[model samples]
Target: MDTQLIRRRMARYVEMVDAGDIDGILGLYADDAVIEDPVGTPALVGLQAIARFYREGLGRTEASAQLTGPVRVAGNGCAAMPMRVDLMWNGEPCSLHVIDVMEFDDKGRIRSMKAYWGELNVERRPE
Candidate 1:
């Protein structure tokens, strides 16, 4: 896979998330893709489960994510980015510093995504 293409896709992921474009976000993944947001939790498999996960997390909230550093791409169809996600969680405004790694399928769609984050990475955001 071309590293440039992987970088573009990685950047697009953040853009779509900030725009709350659920469909666009889904389009980034393959039909059989899997996601492990904040890895260690059970992975969400397939587009159906992925759709549910995004819907519940976004849910009419002003959620947004911004890349904090350049996207790191590997020749092996993988890329990772560090980003800060600002959103309303449990009715409280907060932000999380997260690093997300994604693997691309032969078709260029994301095949697997694993987000690395923990409670220590979270902070309250001023409304």
Candidate 2:
């Protein structure tokens, strides 16, 4: 597994997110990939679960995300990227800075992803 290749693939995934191409974003993960989200309770596993989580968390909310810097690969098919998320949550606007750690399987598809971030502040949008 080449770290550079994984990094590029991850970058493409982030780009898909920024473009609001949900299907494109989901296509990056393997069928059985797991995602540990900051807000979700249990780890979402498999394509269906992952899609549902994203639909509720990101799709339903007014949100935008961008990768802040280049992805850093650890030479073990693992990579991390800093991201900035702007979104509306519970009728409030919020911003979050997060680091996404991704692990790729032998086939170069993402096998797991975990996002680390601080608690978000819930604030009503300015009228």
List model 2 lDDT by residue over 30-105, tens digit each. Answer: 9999999873558989999999887777777767778888899998889999887777755667667788999999
**Best candidate (score: TM-score):** 1
- Per-model TM values vs. the true structure: 0.96, 0.86
| Alpha-carbon lDDT of model 1 | 0.93
Lowest summed lDDT window (length 10), candidate 2? 118-127
What is the C-alpha lDDT profile of model 1 across 8-86, one tens digit per residue?
A: 9999999999999999999999999999987999999999999999998875788888999999999999999999989
| Pairs of residues clashing in candidate 2 | none
Local distance difference test, each candidate = 0.93, 0.81
Per-residue error (Å), model 2, residue 51: 0.8
**Which structure among the candidates has the greatest lDDT?**
1
Candidate 2 ranges with C-alpha deviation above 4 Å: 120-127
